[model samples]
Target: MDRLTNPIRPYAWGSTTAIPALLGVEPTGEPQAEMWMGAHPGAPSRVDRGAGEVPLSEVIAADPEGELGAAAVAKFGPALPFLFKILAAGAPLSLQVHPDLARAKEGFEDEERRGVPIDAGHRNYKDPNHKPELICALTHFDGLCGFRPPLEAADLLEGLGVDSLKPYVDLLRAHPVDAALREVLTAVLTADRAEMARTVADAAAAAERLGGPYAPYAGLVHHFPGDPGVIAAMLLNHVRLQPGEAMFLGAGVPHAYLDGLGVEIMANSDNVLRCGLTPKHVDVPELLEVVVFEPGEPAILRPEDEGEEVYETPIDEFRLSRYVLAPGAAPHSLPDTAPQILLCTAGRPRAGELTLAPGESVFVPAGETAVLSGAGTVFRATVVV
Candidate 1:
């Protein structure tokens, strides 16, 4: 097991204090958004296995089969299939959706064939891999996920009683579930910028005045006033996750994290299609193609005991499980069939010989004999095999 030194992504939407508090460090005052803990090449974690401190990607690349095990390399290619993260949201992330595998490949290859630069702002697919994710809240987390039933959504908007929003409310009531959501979202995204800005402002004011169920929307406008996503966001279901609760965001699910801290794990891909609420490029046409238009409730996942308490998700790229250690509980053997990143989130737990404090993690190669002992909450990230 190698002690991992991860990179903290200082995105503007990050919380200044949440990640610092977890790591027992002083806030640098800059936003600390995500502490990435895997080999993604973009921000791969660092590890020192005697030779010198090097990026984990280089270490894995040198001996993919040895580090990741033969099965993982064969199954998910030479790269680590999962990217684990500690995501801290001080503000709302973009209203975004990710492409499914087929769409991802088509988009990536299409861009490459057209000679579009990979780093170009307009470029959508960062890689030809589907990014399905699970976020398990470490605090009282707030987010918007999927879509509500059309009439239900219309009721929420109608209650706000903003005149400019009446058209959307009428549209929502006029069409079938999927079409209502599709038309409202299309109108929100494709509307005249100045006109949409006015609507967003009105909606924001109404949300603020209403201030009950409408509070989260008011907060969105507080951060990004006049942004059309403030309106598009209302099309989705609002989810507030208490500690230890989880939500799985599958491909094409339109979602945004509004606030609080969470432990997130996803397939190692960064293909995102944005709807709104960002200064970043909004490929409306692409996003319309990528979003799943069906209305459904967000699935809130809780851990189930299957030797370890697992937060079950459908993707094979990653599996997340939690362990809450008491003072006298017997040590548990870690699953050794896959490469693992063991993160200690609270107290001091021992992973093999390395004792870990909150925010500390270790990279345990596949086939390693590892045991968990001591009193702390540890979240384990590994492949499904």
Candidate 2:
């Protein structure tokens, strides 16, 4: 097992302290967002084997199926087709949707056929796989997932009594799901600039008046001023998950990670169809095509206890288990059947003489059983199918 030095994503929405604290580094004042720990080619985790740092991709390629194991190879082909992340979202992410498997493959191939560069910022699809994701909250995570019933949203907006929002309230009350959403979204996005400014001002005041956690949402309104996403967000289900809780996002789900710390695991793809809430790239037609119009509450995943510190999720690409180990505890004997990555999240943990501090991780190849004797909380990542 080589000591892994993972890549950290520098996003504006990232937390300045959470990941920095984990790595024993003082906050850089800037957001140090996601610390990724997997062999996905986009930003592969690096292995420090005493000599120097090498991408985990190089390590995996040496053995391919052997490193990840036969099961992962059979399920996802000759690759560790998953990416794991310690995500910290201080600000909201773009409201976006991912394509289903078939659509993803087709979209990827089409982009490739057009000679689009993979690293291009405007490129929509990066891989030919669906990005079904599971986020286990490390802190209180607030987000908007799926969609709230239109009538419920209408009631909320009507109660707000912002005349500019009356159009949306009327649309929701009058039209069906697709037409109501499309019409309202179009009007919001393409509204008169001055009118939108006035509308947002009124809406923000109303949002604050409604009170509670959503009062802070008014502040976000100032950032994305007059942006349709602020209005669109009202139509989505507002969800908050406490620590150890999880939420799943399947393809075509119109969702946005609002804020907080979480561990996100997804299929090894970066295909995103963005609608709004950011200035990066918004492919409205494509987004509209892929996003599901269904309205419902977000699906919260409850991990089944397997009686061995194993937390089984409904995903096949990765299985994550949490181990809270105190000092003087016996060494953890991990399963030898598959490749596993052990990440220490709290305190210092020892594997023989090598001590893994918080944020430090170790990648154990398949068919190798290692013992972890530590004074910390460690999360084990391995392929399930």
Candidate 3:
């Protein structure tokens, strides 16, 4: 087992205190967005072995099959397949969607053939991998996921009483699910920027005035008033997750985290296509092709309360589960078939011989015997195979 030293990303939308409070450290007064704990190359966690600290990416590359196990190496290539994170959102994230595997491969190859720089602002596909994610809320996490029914969305918009938005409400009520959602979203994104800003302001005013279900959207408009994403966000279903509940975000699903903290895990990829609520380049044509034009309620997941609580997802790259340890409980014999990252979110949990405090973690290589005991909340991240 290797003691992992992870990297914290300071994104502008990040909370100032949430991560610090978890790490038991003083705040630097800047936003601490995410504490990443896997080998994503962009920000790989470091592990201190006998030879001193080394990047986890390099450590894996040096001996992939030995570290990741033969099954993982054969299935997901010579890599750690998943990236685990502690995400803290203070404001709203970009209205974004991810490409499916086939689309991701096509987009990446095309961009590479065109000689686009990897770090270019307009670059859509970061790598040729699909990012299917699941976020388990540590707090009351607020977010927008998928799409609400067209008629329901129409009713919500119609209630706003904005003249400019009447066209959308009419469109929603006029068409079927796919066309209604697609056309309304297209109209919102392709609208004149100045006109859309005015519409967003009016909508914000109305959302504030009618503060029951509309209260969440009013906050998005508050953060990004001029952003057309505020209007785009209205097309999605608003969801709030209490502690212990989880939400899964699959390919081509339009979503955004509005506020609060969570434990997020996804395939080891960085490909993101934006729809709105950001200064970053949004490829509307690409995003349109990528988004799934379906209307339904978002799945709010609750963990299956087995001996070790498990949050089940449909993908093979990542599997996330948690254990809320009580005083004087028997140690858990964690599965040693795959590589694992054990994160302590509260109290002191023993991982092998090391005692972990909140925000501390360890990387156990495949076949390593790890017995987790002591009182704490520990989240386990491993591969399905």
> lDDT per model, in order?
0.92, 0.80, 0.93
For candidate 1, write residues 69-171 as lDDT tens digits.
9999889999899999999999999989989999999999999999999999989988899999999999999999999899989999989888888999999
**Predicted candidate 2 versus true structure: per-residue lDDT over 110-199, tens digit per residue:** 999999999888888988888888888888898889877888878877777788788789998899987777777667767876888787
The Cα RMSD of model 3 versus the native structure comes to 0.9
Q: Give candidate 1's TM-score.
A: 0.98
What are the per-residue Cα lDDT tens digits for candidate 3 across 1-385? Answer: 9999999999999999999998999999999999999998999999988899999999999999999999999999999999999999999999999999999999999999999999999999989999999999999999999999999899999899999999999999999899999999999999999999999999999999999988889988777877889988888899999999999999999999999999999999999999999999999999999999998889888876855898889999999999999989999999999999999998998997999999999999998988999999999999988
Off by over 4 Å in 2: 119-121, 177-179, 190-197, 304-312, 326-331, 351-353
> Positional deviation of 236 in candidate 2, in angstroms?
1.2
Best by lDDT: 3
Q: Candidate 2: lDDT over CA atoms?
A: 0.80
